[model samples]
Target chain A: MARASVTRLTGRPLLSRRQDGLALRRAMPDRLLPALVAAMTFLAALALAGAVGASLLAQRWNNGAAAIMTIQVPDADAPAATGAGKRGDAVLAVLSHDPAFAAAIPVDRARLAALLAPWLGGAGGSGTGAPALSLPGVIQARLRPGVDPPADLAARLESAAPGTLAERNQPWTARLVALTRSLQACAALALLVVTGVAVAVVAAATRAGLAARRHSIEIVHGLGAGDGYIAGRFARRTTVLALSGGIIGTILSVPLLLLLCRLGAPFASGAALPPTLPDGDLAAYLSDALARVPLPLWIALPLLPPVSASIGWLTAQFTVRAWLRRLP
Target chain B: MIRLDEIALRYPGRDPNRGAVLQRISADIPSGGFRWVLGASGAGKSSLLRLLSLSLKPTSGQLEVLGVSVNRARRAALARLRRRTGTVFQDLRLLGELSVFDNVALRLRLDGLPEDRIELEVTEMLRFVGLGRKLDVRPHSLSGGEQQRVAVARAVVHRPPLLLADEPTGALDEKQAIRLISLFEELNQMGSTVLVATHNEALVRRFGHPALVLERGRLVSHG
Candidate 1:
């Protein structure tokens, strides 16, 4: 026959060496604190994930179009101010010769129509033989590193081709950086708040445990157990609870994080992932999905438990020690 | 030895007259001395024991237990002194969650005694108290008399130099109470200072030890 179980069916280890003198197991129940801590850890994980995601986004934007500048010439087919070629061709020649820019790519009418297809639906029309709206000639060129975008480059372009306008992308790049920094700051603040809340949760749970076991505590204390002994017991218990909570919270956050990374993968890569997945290969899909999360996050997720345990240990130690001052 | 000089205990409050528990009481007991603390229910016998056990700091006074000045001792020093003392409460404050053996072994364990030695000592003490078969039994499972014995066993298991019992056998029958007192006498013979507080004049007469008598928060008699 099964024993009439007084203790809840816990996965307590079969063999034990040390004894719990205070019987803190019954004094501090395992459920409420760990559950609350797990919730806090989950929020912390998300906050950290957000910070990491913002960093990756900043890197992507920095490496992407932020280094490129654009030059647009109106009335491109018209005569150039230089009296040598079409205005658009003149502007291209000047840009191509300049050491500051590289890989000057001229946008043709059909490509221009495709670019504008979202705004002007007629871009999808008739083979694009001279777009209905007379679009300016658009030229994109990568700005080489250490290349000072000459302040007078726009004037030079205007001289080569009348009405040519140079759009410096540097300000927008700085703005993007500032935006990402703001996002990272917000994520950092969220992380600090979450950690603060986790500490508070552990502290409150510890106080409750102390209150619930006042008699037991008084007995041990009266038996000559020092503040360190009593506080150490509470710290050990809370550390285990917080560590377990952190591990569980981190584990639970993984799939959700993976899904989020997968959804945001297109924004990072600047293109949609191909839908044609190979059939009947679950491992392949899982590996692919795992690859979506950043390597830094992989390293960081495993650290939450130890960090959480440290917080719990420190919080319980101080709280219990402070509370014991009321005893003697 | 224990020394007290004009010790007073009072609950801090606006009304001074209603708060004093033990007041202007001074006494001394040498090493290896045994004395019964005589008082009524509302008298301050328990509070005096609480002061000796280092669980309560007197509101104002001088107290020295086991040669450490209770008034000036650091908390850590007091804890060390407390480790050298043992107490058996009237309520038999056995940790309900622990078994009889563990309750008896708590002080030794806290002192970092070796497990094998602790087990041996706790087992012997339990047997001496006639609860040898109930080593693993919880305190609540025992009868009132048996529970008092457990408390007594725990108090003396470490052979503390200063043994203080606050109504130690208040719940025991005459046979059980006498047996418990004999245990204290045996410990006192073994060179421990044992102080038992009780209102039972019959028990006091049976033991015929010197007594410290209190009335209305004052030490009324000592012989």
Candidate 2:
């Protein structure tokens, strides 16, 4: 008389017996649950990926920004460039002598010219028939970890080499950190909302399914089937459906994710670009402005299906048990 | 065995006040007793059977079935009580998608009986009810009499101590009805307490079993 023994005798699995006992008919059209779950999971995966990427990008930018300083020497008094060169070399020599500074390198004219080429038009220098622009001499410094440059270091450099300014550029780095944090928060919020909506959708469908099978359920209950027995059947069915939909949704999202990655690849790979650029190099400038996400973050995408399945299973169990309490 | 003490069943109505379906009704059916509940249509015969089967709670009375005081039984206890009894619904509530064999085997399955025993018992019961050939057929595909037989087989396949049938022969022809009554008699002789509720007084009179009569939701006679 045990259900297990009966299943063994009938050669039907437990799920088949439960489903068959409920009289599988088109009485309940539940095609929507899986589809909805799949769609939600797809959206959730994308949001999760975005949040992870933003977090990693923020950390990278914070570390990179914290360890660097820039020194700009203007050519206001020198003959078009000689005075700027001497002041830049003087600043580099000063930085090199400090034990706290790991490296101090001067930016060559060709590299500086190339950096200004986007705005001035053509290649570095005046060779590309672009406007002749007076650019400053720049020195880049790398500091040892935990080393704070002396607060009076910039004043000392300015007094020794006139018309030169020193900057740690912490404010810009702070702004970038804040922006990435906001983006990560938004992505997390979106993920939570999508998962909640998916669970709600499954719960609603389970109720409808129970309503359609109410008569059969009553018959089974009258015949001595326990509430746990009935609820297990529903939970199993919904779990399978939700898991399938989640996998499909996750699989479908891969192409979209790849396309997004491709679109942002150029920006992620390049150095920071100026705010304003010539009309022709806008794509390149945009590419340089964005950072490519690291590979490890993709691992989280595969976990969505199982998470969705667990949610579906719990929702169905709760819905069925609550509904059964109202029965005789 | 079944016992009722001033059992009153009142279904909630759209209006705030409605009379009980069965008011101040009391009766006792001893073990192995074959009883006929005779009444006109809507005389609460089905309602009484539902109470005996533990499908409904008495509004203001006590009920005992198979030695268990079911009126105050918890859900799990009621389920155990239900398992000891079998009911043949008036509408023949066989799962339409299941084969006749599966329908009859369901009761034994619920009891967690072994597969070989379920198969042997279900097959024998179907054969006794003259439905052996239709074992693989769905209930919807069977004739009315065949469907009734399927319901009867399903009810008694597990050999429960109490068997309650509500208008089981309503859909049968005279010859088929007699055959069904004989089958019930055979089961009664095997020591199950049988209660058949029907509006067909002639059939009840012909069998001449100990009987109860209900009139307008009240027990009018027990003889």
Instruction: Give the CA lDDT, 0 to 100, for residue A219 in model 2.
Output: 87
Worst window of 10 by summed lDDT in candidate 2 chain B: B11-20
Whole-model Cα lDDT of every candidate shown, in order: 0.84, 0.79
Q: Please state the error at residue A48 of candidate 2 in Å.
A: 2.2
Shares of reference contacts reproduced by the candidates, in order, are 0.52, 0.41
Q: State the lDDT at A160 in candidate 2.
A: 54
Complex DockQ, candidate 2 = 0.33
Model 2, native contacts kept? 0.41
Instruction: Give lDDT: candidate 2, residue B7.
Output: 89
Worst 10 residues of 1 chain A by lDDT: A1-10
> For candidate 2, lDDT tens digit of each residue in A67-173?
78888877622532235445666677778998878998888877877777777765446466553666777888878877888888877677657778878856797
Which lDDT tens digits does candidate 1 get at residues A110-137? 7777877888778444355546777788
